[model samples]
Structure formats: structure tokens, C-alpha cells
Target: MRIALIGRPNCGKSTLFNQVAGYKAETGNFHGTTVTYTESKVRVLGEVVDLVDLPGTYVLGGSNPAEKVSHDYLGDHPVDVIINVIDATFLAQSLELTLELLRLDKPVLLAMNMMDEVARLGIKLDGPALEKELGVRIVPVVASKGRGIKALFLEAKRAAEQGILQPRFDDFQDDPYSRHKAALQLSQRFAVQGQRTLSWRDRLDDIFLHPAYGYVALAGVLLLFFQAVYGVGQLIEPPLLALFDSLITNLNTYIDTGNLLGVLLNGVLQGVMAGFAIVLPYLFPFLLGLGFLEDVGYLPRIAFLMDSLMHRIGLHGKAIVPFILGYGCNVPAIMSTRTLEDSRERFIAAALSTLVPCAARLVVVFGLVAFYLGPLYAFGLYLLNLFIIALTGRILTRLLPENTPGMILEMPPYRIPTLRAVANKAWFRIREFIVEAWPTLIFGSAALGLLVFFDIAKYFNWMVRPITWLLDLPAEVGVPLIFGVLRKELSLIMLGQALGNNDYSAVLSNAQLFTFTVFVVFFVPCVATLVMLKRELGSRQMVWVTLITIIIAMGAGLAARIFGLLL
Candidate 1:
């Protein structure tokens, strides 16, 4: 049996998925679609069944990959039943989406989640009445607490065997406005409002979502977040790197360091050191903090805070999701452009999203600027990054004009983050680096070492000399810049090989370090991101984006060099 899970974001869809997703659960792109969904094999009703979790979206009919997946899967796949997860706190909007599912004429088991929060809000929902009204089974569940999940799946299994039930109300029509009104009427009739007591969660939003204090608080939160990452990275990185350097010096005693075999061996070692010492030190803690913020439901509030500012770039607040994801990795950030309805907005969001300083670029900034200079210098680089991104957005928007609609989002209530969930999320990302990126870094580092030993690297250095000259950086940096396009971490790792020194501060001045880091941060994204841009946009736009990035990097690097000189 195949049972699908569907719901809007912040409705506990992910919580429920985690509850039931066995180790077999994995996320992948749907066949013939670019966006992804998760599927798992689970035993339900004494039989192993396929449980699929679709992407979270507010409306299924909207113009996004979610719509295409919904229409394609529901229309063709053997989807026996759908478990529509609903947030009881936002019944009106949740039910409005349920109405969309009913139009499919498929069996739906309504899972009303977050009942605990509902009760605390003093909102009463008549389960039986709503079930009767909608002609579906309604199961009250608190997914995070593991309440009612067993019975919920049991009902889902039963519904799959029973087949489809016709929607009870004829008020459901083709029009969206009609569906909205009907959902509102049904919630009013079935739910009763009680004496509400204000809680800390309510007041928390008042501060987090406040106009004046919110930005101040955001700055404070970010400052602490970066400090924590830098602190942990600082303490661990020095001892580890020193150990590796000592081992390399000892290895030189066994054989000549200039020989071909010795150079290749050392190159591979540097790659491993880069991933373990320089990258993971900063990457893990950054991801941990990001996951905590995400689980605590603070990310969307940032979008709300930045919505007005986002409009200055020809995008809506919803477009900020890609930017947030970009900080983690640019591949997923590009993938997230599907959530934006307008093509122009998607392009603009994707373009700016790449500039958000991903974890790879994060390592570069933290390793060189933050580590050698200070956190304040690294912080200055980030400020410069955002300013450049905003300036680029302003330019792009003027070229392709559009008026984006204001954001309408359901704010999930703040909940204490679970260690298991946050850690697992961070682990998944770190594991991806271990499995996919680490190998590339090791092999690329080795290849770069061979090129430098053979004197062929000078050609690559020659190719990028114009940009290096313009930025007032060392000519040898051109080779690392060329190879860095394959993987951003290579920019720094190979720089050590090209200059014949592992210690950057000993070789390069403060101005050179500042300028080079700026260039790497804004230069062409990694090959993965480039492929994703091509997949998302088109070949033509991909070329345009790549070219535009090279130009931007040159401009930003030169600007940083001039600033360094003036200071």
C-alpha cells in the first residue's frame, strides 16, 4: 500500500515524518521532476507499505514544483490514501488546503496535529463534527509528543483499503476564493473560541517580530552565533593543524619533499587536513546553530522581518527561503527557487542566494579572515557581502521589473528543539560533506599539486591574471581561483600548495588575504551550483549567471583591495 503525507509548512509535517520514517526513509527527486520528496517503507496494519512525504506548500494548485508533483503523482501514481496533516492553531488556512485535496476525489485521512498547542490557545475543535462535515476520518494528534500517531497510521491504513469518499459539501468549487470562504465557514461552525490567556510564546514573537527591537535582536543573535562557531573552530583547529604540519615535516625526513611521489602524497594530506581541520571546525557548529533556529521556528520570523527590504530587490518575503537555504549550501538554495512563483523572482532569488556565503565559502571567510585577523574582520567581510548582494539585487530588479505580492505565511508556534532532530540534521549535512565533497577536495588537491610541480599551473595562473592584477593579489592565486570553481574549499587548500607555504599569514599581507577572500566569496559558484542553475533556469541563463558572477567577483575584489589600501 502507498500512503502519502501532505501539508503546509510549520504544520508538523516534518515532525510526523520523523516519527514514522524508518531508516529506509530517504529524500530524492520525484521521477520526471526537479523538486524532491521523501519515501520510506514501513509496516502499517500488519503489512509493509510505502509512506511518502510530499513537499510542504500552502496551495497544491499554485505554480511551483509542488503543483506539478501533486498533479502528476495523484493523477498517475497508485496513491491509495493521503494523510492531510493540519495545524490546529491555523485551522482556517489549513482547512483551506484540505479543500484542495478533496477536489482530487481521493481518500484523505485528516490528521489534526498540534492539539496540545490548540488546547493551550483555548481553542476547541469538535473532531467528530469536523470528520462528519468533511466526510473523512479526523485524528487528533500531537506529532512531536508521539500522541495519537499509532491510531493515526492505523486509520490511514484502513482508509487506503477502503477507497475514496466523495467530499460532503457542494460548496467546494473550482475557484480558490470560494474554497477560502467555505473553509472559514466550516471552522467557525465546528470550532469554539474560549477565554484566551497570553503566554510567553505570544510575547516572544512580539520581540522577535518587532520592527525596531527585532533587527537589534537579530544582530545580537547573529553576533553570538558567529562567535560560538568561531570559538569552537579556533580552539580545535590550531592543535589539529599543528599535528598535521608536524607529521608532514617528519615525512620529509623519509624522502625528498620535491619528488613527484612526495608532492602527491603531501597534496592528499593537505586535502584531508583542510576538510577535517579548517572546514568541519566551522561547518558543524554553523549547521548546528542553523538547525536549532530552524526547529525553534525562528527562520520564518526573519523572512517576516525582511519582507519590506526584500521588495527593494523585486522579490517577496517568501523568496527569502532560498536565501536562508543558501547559507547552508547553494545547490539546495537553487533547488528552492521552485518555491517562488514568478520566473523573474526565481532568477533574482537564485542569483542573490548564491551570494549568501555558503558553508564552503563560510570556511574560507572564517579560516583566513576570522582566524588570522579577528572575528570583527570576518564580520566586516560578511557585512560587505550583504551590501554587495543588496546592490546586485537592486541592479537586477531594475533590469527585469515586477511587483511581487506580499507574503502570507502561517507562523509555527515556538517549541523547544529536540537534540536528536537538530543533531541528526547537522549530521546529515556533515555526512554529505564527508561522502561527496571530501573526496573531491582530496583528489582535486592532489591534481593541483601535480600541476604546480609540473609548471602547468602557471598557465591557469596566466588565464586569471587580469582579475588578480585588478584585485592587487598575488599572481599565483590565479591557479587556485581557476580550480576553486570545482569546489570552493579548494580555493584555500590549493593556495597553500601553490605558494609552497601552509602558513598564509607568513606569505601574504593582510590586504592580500582580505582581497583574495572577497574574490572567492563572490566568484562563480561551485560546479554543483552551476549544474543546478542550469537545471532550474536554462542553459542560456546559466551562462549569463556564471559570467555575471565573474564580473561581480572582480568588482568586489577590487573594491576590497582599495578599501584595504585606504585603511
Candidate 2:
């Protein structure tokens, strides 16, 4: 049997899904967190059942792509049971969607999630009365805490097995206003509000959501986040690099360095070493921190704080989510742009998101710029990337010329981020980078190494000499620049291999190093990000984005070279 989990945004549906599905789905306290559906199999009542977590939608007839996913799936797919997870604290608003699910003529089990929030909010809900009125099994659950989940699924299994399709309002109209009115009437009958008092969440919101202090808090939090990533990388990278270096030295004592076997061992193993030594060190901590932010409900606050800045760039505040996610990886960042209601905004957001320095680009920035120059110079490059993104966003906005929508975001109550959830999400994201990206890096490295072994790299270098001269970089950099599109870190790793040494300062001056790093930062995204861009924004748009980024990268490199010459 196949069961579908459906609910309005931030209604704890995803939380419940992750719990029952063994943390297979990513949970966020924001709208459109799950832009696509996720499926996993679970055993309920000794029966193996397929469970799907659908994108959250406030209503069935919504226009956004994320909502359409849920709207279409429910209409087209056959499900044995529908689990409508409701936010117990907001019964009136949540029941509108609940009413829509009832009309689907499927066995529906209402999981009243966030019951702890209901108690804190002083909202008194009579579960039995509500169940009788709605004519469905109502199970009160706190999904984050795993409270009442066993009973929730047991009731769901019973509903699915019994094939109970109870439609209380047979003649109910499927319009929002009418359903809202019906939901309000129903809520009044079963839910009573006790005396309300300010909770700790409300007190924190005074500072976190403040017009003035919110921005300060955001900056402080981000500064700490980046520092933590950098600090953790510093601790792990040296030992790992030393270990790999020792292994390579020992292996080379027995194997010839001039043969094909040596080339494969040196090239492929170095690529793998670079990924673990450089990329993963920074990426792991960054992902873990991101997961904590999402679970703790701070991401939406960042979005809220970014509303005005996003507006200046002709985007809604929610666009900040993708831009922030871009720091970890651009592929999913670009995909998350689908959450925006406007197609033009989606295109502009995606284009700008591609320019945001992902972890791979960060590897080049920190590995080269910071490693040789200083942390300040490396930090300046990130600031430069943001400036470029803002400028590009302004240009794209003008070109598209559409009215940007006002931000309508729900600020979920802050909760302590669970270590298990954070670890699961971080591992999931890191696994994708390792499983999908590492092979391509290794293959590209080996292929390039073979070309060099055969003395064929000079031909490719000559082919891109004009570009090299334009950027004031040595002709030897041309090959790495070409291979950089395969993977951004490849550019840095290949640069070391191409120059025949890890000490780039020996061959290149500070000016050239700065220029090369600048170029790599703004160049076209990696193969993975490009494919994702095409998938999200269409082939035509992807072409335009690619061309635009290439132009910007060359232009930036030129400007950086001129500045270097002046210095």
C-alpha cells in the first residue's frame, strides 16, 4: 500500500515523514522546503508500505510549481491512505486544507502535530469532539519529539485497512473563502482559547525579528557560521593532507614515477585526496551548521531580514533561502528558486544564485587565496562575489521587468535543533557531493594527467592563449580553466599539477594569483550545477546564464589584473 503525507507549509508533515521514514526526507520550518516528493518504504502493522512525502501546499488549486507538484500528484496518483498533518496551534487555518483532503474520497487520518505548541499557546482542543465532528481519526502528536507517533501510525494503518472515507460536508464547495469559513465554524465548536501569555519564543522574537537588531543578529550569526567552518577546516586539513602525502611518498618509493601506472595513481589519488582534505573539511561543518539553522527555525528569520535587500534586486524575501543554500551548493539552490511565484523572479534568482560562491569555489578561494595571501584577501573575494551577484540581479531584474511580490513568510516558533536530525541532513547533503561529484573530479584529473603525459596539454593551452592573455594569466593556466567547468576544485588541483608543484607562488606572482582566483569564482558553475540549471530554468535560459557568467568572469579577471598592475 502507498500512503501520502500532505499538509500546509510548516505544519509538521515533513517532521512526521522524516520520523516514520527513518530520516529519509529533509525537514525545514519554511514553505516549499520539499520542492519535490520523496518516497521510502516503512513497515506498519507487519505490512510493508510505500510512503511518499509530498510538497506542502496551502490549497489544492495553487499556482506555484511546488504546490502544483502536490496538487497534480494527488489528482493523478492512487494512494491507499492520505495523512493530513495539521498544525494543532493553528487549527482554523490548517483545517481549510483538511477539508479539501476530505473531499478526495480517500481514507484520511488527521495527525494534529505540534501538540506541544498547542499547550504553550494556551489553545484547548477537544480531540475526541473534533474527531467526531470531522468524522476522521485525530491523533495528537509532537513529531519533533516523537511523541504519540506510534499511535498516529497505528491509527493511520487502521484507517487505511478499513478503507474509511468519511466526508462530513458532502456538498462542500472547494473554494478557499468558503472552506475557510467552514473551518472557522468547525474550530469554534471544538477548540477553545485559554488565557494567553508571552512565551520565551515570543521574547526571542522581539530581538530576532526586530527591525534594527535583526540585521545585527543575522550578521553575527553568519560571521560565526563561516568562522566555524573555516576553523574546523583548519583543524582537519593539515593532518589529512600530511597522511595522504605520506602515503603517496611511500607508494612512490616502489612504483616508477614516469609510467602510466604512476600517472593514474598520482592523478586519481590526488583528486580524491583534494576532495577529502580540502572540500569535505569545510563542507561537512557548513552543512551541519545549515541543518541546525533550518531545524532551529532561524532561516526564515534571515529571509525576513533580507526582504528589503531582496526587493532592491527585484526579488521577494524568500529568494534569500536559495541564495543562502547556494553557499553549500548551487544545484539545489537553483532548484529551490521554483518556490518563488513569479517565473521571471525564478529566472533572475537562479541566475544570481549561480554566481554565489559554492563550496567548490570556496575551496579555490581558501585553498589558494587564503592559504597564500591571507584570510582577509580570501574574505574580500567573497564580498566581491556578493557585489557581483547584486549587480547581476539588478540587471536581470530590469531585463525581466516584472512587479515583485511582497514577502509573505511564516516565522515558525524557534525550537532546539536536534542532533540526530541535523546529522542526518548534513550526511545526506555531504553524501551527494561525495557520491556524485568525486568520480567526475577523479576522472577529469586522470584524463588531464594523461593529456599532459602525452604532451597534448600544450595544444589545449595554446588554444586558450588569447583568453589567458586577456586575463593576464600564464598560458599554462588555460588547461585548468577549461577543466574547471568539470568541477571548480579541479581548477585549483589541476593548477598545482599543471605547474608541476603545489607552491604556486614560485611561478605566479600575487597579482596573477588574485586574478586567477577571481576568474574561477565567477566562471560558469560546475557540470552538476549546469545540468541542474538547465533542468530548473530550461535549455534556453541555461545558455543565457552560461554566456552571461562567462562574460562576467572574463571581465572581472581583466579588472582584477589591471588593479594588480596598478598596485
Q: lDDT for model 2, on a 0 to 1 scale?
A: 0.86
RMSD of each: 3.3, 1.7
Show the lowest summed lDDT stretch of 10 residues, model 1. Answer: 25-34
Q: Which candidate comes out best when scored by TM-score?
A: 2
Clashing pairs in 1: none
> Which digits, one per residue and each the tens of the lDDT, describe model 2 over residues 310-345?
888888789999998899889889988988898888
Off by over 4 Å in 1: 22-35, 43-46, 164-178, 255-259
lDDT of 1 by residue, 231-287 (tens): 988988899899888987887788665899988887888899889888998899999
